[model samples]
Target: MKLLILLLAPLFVVLPIYGYQSENLIDFKIKDQFDKVHEKSDFSDKIVVIVGSDREGSKYNDLWVKAILDSLEKNNTGKHVSFIGVADLSAVPFFMRGIVQGFFPSDTTKRILMDWDGEFAETYKFKEEHCNIAIFGKNEKFVSKYPVQKFENKIFEQILNDLRKLFSK
Candidate 1:
């Protein structure tokens, strides 16, 4: 019995470390580029789509956004979806935050949450140097995560299909 317990102990430790576990979005209160506070409760009853990227991954965020918007439009589910942009700007120094913020468009109505301390990305386990897309159901339950290093048709189709299914539900 002791030998068996020892063998299973490693499995128990490793499973929690690397195994897949269902996670729900935590109740987070963060500010957007416009300094508007957003919380998980604000998006309740709507399918939330989170597009996150680090400095190196910023280039791919636009492509992912376009695809997500297109999918929502195609399904006619725009009203049911809440899009949230999260920029992982943890690496930017305090003094440089203003300079980085200046780079973002000033006229856009869309709000992009600035993750100054990387808390959001760390919680979601967002991939570095890749466009990380996470879809949550209306209940705020995590549906899926797609970390795209390069854009591809298949990947786009998969995202489209996922959105379609979620909307259908």
Candidate 2:
């Protein structure tokens, strides 16, 4: 029993325990694909939307982005909302980072932040193999995290309704 406990202790220390904690998001600094540093302070006084995904969940990111963008355009709420994309690259080996980066688009308009160490994902308790959507109101106050296993209209509408309520306030 002692031997088994000793062996498993290291795993517990190394692996991130996933759970949603209701607390304000602490400050963090991370670089985007364009090497632009984005910190919590940068999003002050804005309704920030953070869309994060691992490699498997990445396919659904664009659909969410499009839906959010379309909603913003239709409601003329573009100025109130800020979108940030975070790619969970913790699984990518160090040597493969450059190769993986090469696969990203060259567009300068949108920024795709890289969570190289999975710190952000762990902090947010992101669901594996699913798109994670977190919204923060002004002053870095965490509003909610939408569990998105796959794109669904009902879930999307709920998100939009929450955003609309936030915008109205």
Candidate 3:
């Protein structure tokens, strides 16, 4: 019984983000590195891309975030996609965001922010999950969510395809 209880314990964990609702996705006040405000609704009628990342100082995050951003750039849709760094929202280690940034090119299209406490992560349910990409419609409705690593000829490709679908509607 002890072993069984231990195994089952992990199952009860609750994800930070309950789920995305299209209606609740708009009129946003998300922070930018410039200490400016980005209205979630500005992307209204456009697709909103939100990435929840943990500030782990590893080459893995760099590769993943870069790949994710690169795919967004190729998206034919004119929607705005943002990649929020874990450090910006929470108290992620200083070095971790830098490491992820290093992997990316200077002119990358995706906008990245430091998520220090990961309010965005939990709001988007990124920490308890992997590849927690959420697509909100122009009307601020939740459309779709996909894992970063699963499909796409590559992980990033899959993300782009999802974006196309998001903006196509």
Ranking by TM-score: 2, 1, 3
For candidate 1, lDDT tens digit of each residue in 41-118? 898998888899998887898887887787778767788988888999988999999889878767667688888988
At residue 136, candidate 2 shows an lDDT of 80
- lDDT score for residue 110 of model 3: 47
As a whole number from 0 to 100, the lDDT of residue 118 in candidate 2 is 82
lDDT of 2 by residue, 1-169 (tens): 9999999998787664444454676677998887789887887788888899898888888888899889888989978888888899999999998888877768987688888998768788877888899888766778888858667999899889878888988
Q: lDDT of each structure?
A: 0.83, 0.83, 0.53
Instruction: Determine the C-alpha RMSD for candidate 1 after optimal superposition of all C-alphas.
Output: 3.1
The segments of candidate 2 whose C-alpha lies over 4 angstroms from its true place after superposition are 1-16, 19-22
Q: Least lDDT summed over 10 consecutive residues: which range in candidate 2?
A: 14-23
How close to the true structure is residue 168 of candidate 2, measured as C-alpha lDDT?
84
lDDT per residue as tens, model 3, 7-121: 8876566432254433356344655554455665456555565555543432244566666566566653333664434332365466675554455434544445545455555
User: Model 3, stretches more than 4 Å misplaced?
Assistant: 1-23, 57-75, 78-88, 92-111, 128-131, 149-158
lDDT of 1 at 152: 89
Q: Cα RMSD (Å) per model?
A: 3.1, 4.4, 7.5
